[model samples]
Target: MRKLILLVAMLAMVLVGSVPALAQSTLSGDQGANPPESDGGSVRGIITDISGSVVLVEADPSASSGPKGYFTVTDETEIARLEGDIRIRASFEDLEVGQQVQADYAGPIAESYPPQGEAGSIVILDEGGETDREATLSFELEVECDPPANAAFFGFIPAEGGINAQLTDPDEDGVYTGSVNVPKFPPGPAPPGTEPVSLPVQIVQVRGVIKDFGEVKIDGDKTFKATVSFCDDNGGGSGNGGSSSGGGKTLPNTGGVLPITLGAGALLVAGGLLARRLGR
Candidate 1:
């Protein structure tokens, strides 16, 4: 009986030692983990408001339609990086409250009632369609030209049609500098005569009156025009105060034409007189 009891204790000790090894192997191997590819489709939403880790977003109705219609934006670190007030292409711009936008997203689905929310990220795709996405429709107001030493002039109000854009002048000069966040608009179906659709930034010529200046109120609105070159990933430069038709403009070379002709005529007359004198 004593020997049998000893043998039973030995067996228990061996089993305990082997249990840890089996657990380690399971953890190192499959470990019952789900792959990331299992998550399909994407969700898009706007950051309407932020409360702690919860982000209230007004998602696009067209994208979120059907059974999984409702979508909300949560305060996830990954999602915050992609948000700005106006959705400009390439440059970081703000999105206005009423402005429409699209978001790309993907995550896990809930299995229980009330639908437990899944974690995911979102990126701004588009603001509105072509008619709304033109550059000429927007305006950039210069607040101040001369900033304080080492300090830049800040704060410019966005007009009714445009979104609020902040400028950061690194040189501390009055020149306000900043990026505008534009939306990534999707391509439409190809028309019969048109070539296959490709994504390109739309260029526009802006023509409007400067309703108001920075914090300081100007006496009257200033009428001006500028050309905006914009694209999904990049945009560049502004040319203002010009007519669409290239006309009535004095070209550089035209000024010299009259002077050269007069000089040649004068020289020819002088040569004729000199020849008469030499012949006599």
Candidate 2:
């Protein structure tokens, strides 16, 4: 009968070509439908100024339904791995100043910028790009006395010194940042009194070691200030500590009595000049 009408018009063109791949696998449930002409290149903003590696985002031009441009994030460690706590998500969580953001970006497409300045634009979830390969150590700190406003400034982890993390300044305006992960700093000079002498690192798992430092607290005052940096695998930098403009210095909680009181006053002035040269 004409082969049953040619198998019913070849099963109605294979069910209309499987209805757009089963409606794109049921709206990407299993992942398979991101192409309505797919742009995948976006950037919606409102982050006005961030200094030190520069970040001045302010383009919400109506949160783009599509098409509209003007971007700049120039990689400050990818904008601190996409704003982890940048003064509390870009200024006290309200995230205002024209609140709005959307970013996807691919990479490399400069017209006139790109010296060390180029994240191009990727503000989607506000910031995303840190698979946790583990290795982060950022820096900046300043506070020469005056820390008791609420008390909460502790950071020190140069591979066993301990206490690695706890800092705040979400625009309270005192200057203190964050980052941590330790277990590597064996190049030299870090075991003597240990107050940040020098540490610049970027090495993963050879024994860890990711440090980003800061310290400060002021409202009533009790003394506080610190700034440090280190990242293992050999490739990171920053260092500084108490006294020398960092203020705050009083240490000496016993033991070794201030170098044994300067070695017993230099052995009583060298035994009274050797008993006056054996009594002349």
Candidate 3:
């Protein structure tokens, strides 16, 4: 009986000692798995492809160069979609191709030609990092004199190329009618770490570019003006959305396996103690 009790005590000590070892092993395994923790870096680019949980990004999109590397976004990653004045919390599944994103690393990037890293957070940005809203300007010009062939229309509007449009005279009438699609760009730069603010543009000028039309008139007036509004209700926003000034921060690394490991260790220790008591 004495020998048995001694053996049981020894066995109990061995089990107690093994528990911590097991726990340590479990912790190490949980932390050491592939796609290691990010040391500290970030990449801002367009997401080109998504395979399973991995996302391929094109770091130098301006040159259409090779994809920089693959980034994996896990459940811990924080994803946000930014519109002009709205922000939506999103997930990995919500990610899609052709969208610009700023990805923050969750671990040290793999030192490969095309690097690899885990995404700690992702923010979807609008194309060109600017809010693009479109408006339409329509006008009709009546020529008092004979019209010239191959004549074009121009608008003194707030847009690129001076808001140019083509006027087509379907009938033989002297009235030439056309509409210009005007895109509204942000009036000014956005505040640092914020979205660009959009204001209404009350009025713009539309004119006839008829160089040979001796006289051009609209509503018996020499010059024509159109009212323009950039309100949200008028569908003035672009479908691609807007840019994000500041993106999400990195999240703390955590593991669910630790709790299960601790529970198993506790059970082993309890079983060992119970056996020792029985031996006594």
The true-versus-predicted C-alpha distance at residue 235 of model 2, in Å, is: 32
TM-score result, candidate 1: 0.28
Model 2 lowest lDDT segment of ten: 200-209
Ranking by lDDT: 3, 2, 1
The positional error of residue 4 in candidate 2, measured at the CA in angstroms, is 30
Lowest-sum lDDT 10-residue window in model 3? 236-245
Q: What is the lDDT of candidate 2?
A: 0.40
Output the number of the TM-score-best candidate. Answer: 3
Q: State which candidate, 1 or 3, has the greater TM-score.
A: 3
Error of 2 at 50 (Å): 42
Query: Candidate 3's residue-wise lDDT over 144-229, tens digit each?
Result: 33422323334334324334555556895755566654443344543323332222211211211122222221211123333221
Q: List the RMSD of every prediction in angstroms.
A: 20.8, 20.5, 40.1
lDDT against the true structure, each candidate:
0.36, 0.40, 0.54
Summing lDDT over every window of 10 consecutive residues in candidate 1, give the lowest-scoring window. Answer: 195-204
Report residue 3 deviation for candidate 2 (angstroms).
32
lDDT by residue (tens digit), candidate 1, 1-280: 9999999999999999999999998886774452221123333444454344433344442442222222344444133222223222221233333333343333654553212243354344444333332222233324322212332221223433444443354564433444433322234432222211112211122322223322322212222222222122122212223212223332223244788889999999999999999999
Residue 157 accuracy (lDDT) in model 3? 42
> How does residue 170 of candidate 2 score in lDDT?
83
Give the RMSD in angstroms, all C-alphas superposed, for model 1: 20.8
